[model samples]
Target: MRVLDRPTFDGWLWLDGYQLNKKGDAVTRRELFVQQAGLRKVSTPAPVPRRGGRQVGSRPSGQPPLVRRDRG
Candidate 1:
């Protein structure tokens, strides 16, 4: 997620995000509204380097993987 604009006087913020597919390519653009005080920074793991001609464990082309959603 990226901050698209400066925070407003009411502490509301606008953000931009990309929805990536299995190939790490951006498939959709998303806009988000959030509160400045409610945001937290998270540490993400480094990306794994490709080992061969293609990424390891990646599915074949033209096949979309099923996405599972968990209710918190």
Candidate 2:
């Protein structure tokens, strides 16, 4: 598991390929801190999606919102 990004919270590492823990099995930083463990940090780059990589319900950057008018 390559480090895709730093932990949103300290002591937690996020990998490039997996995004679940949806099982809610992850313990908090208070429970366990593994900063100095076998983990190593490299100046590696984040993974980029091959396609446009737009997320659902996400608007494009810098575009104005649509204006709507109601006719009576």
Candidate 3:
């Protein structure tokens, strides 16, 4: 039987939801198969849809907040 090799870290990527760390230059078909076998057997929840609304602690939709002038 052919043995599979473990992944080695090469780079990292940051995104809104998750941070992905790429291992090695390119992922081969054999490596993919091995990776799938090594992956944890766990179920994940489906992504939730976004609702139209302003996020909390964010600036208001239109006009900017009042700017204060300093007097010397």
Candidate 4:
């Protein structure tokens, strides 16, 4: 679905009243389209943010963060 307008002004786009977003790994719009629907693009957002909030690498305050180190 294409976002004709951002009435809500959130990061999410209106998938013609459904919704379309690529947030994290639970499941994405592209995955859903690949499984059942077809993917297409009319006009996408002009500038997808270079750094998402967490991508900035700053941990939340007052929280002891335990991170997992991935093996290459």
Q: Best candidate, TM-score-wise? A: 1
Any runs in candidate 1 off by more than 4 Å, and if so which? 6-9, 48-72
Candidate 4 TM-score over all chains jointly: 0.18
Q: State model 1's lDDT.
A: 0.78
Candidates' C-alpha lDDT: 0.78, 0.51, 0.41, 0.46
TM-scores vs. true structure, each candidate: 0.52, 0.20, 0.20, 0.18
lDDT winner, 1 or 2: 1
Ranking by lDDT: 1, 2, 4, 3
Candidate 3's displacement at residue 29, Å, is: 22
Question: Candidate 1, residues 14-47: lDDT per residue as tens digits?
Answer: 8899887665668999998888899988997566
Off by over 4 Å in 4: 1-55, 66-68
> What is the TM-score of candidate 3?
0.20
> Tens digits of per-residue lDDT for model 4 on 1-72?
334453544344444333435532233343111211344457745644445567455678898776879999
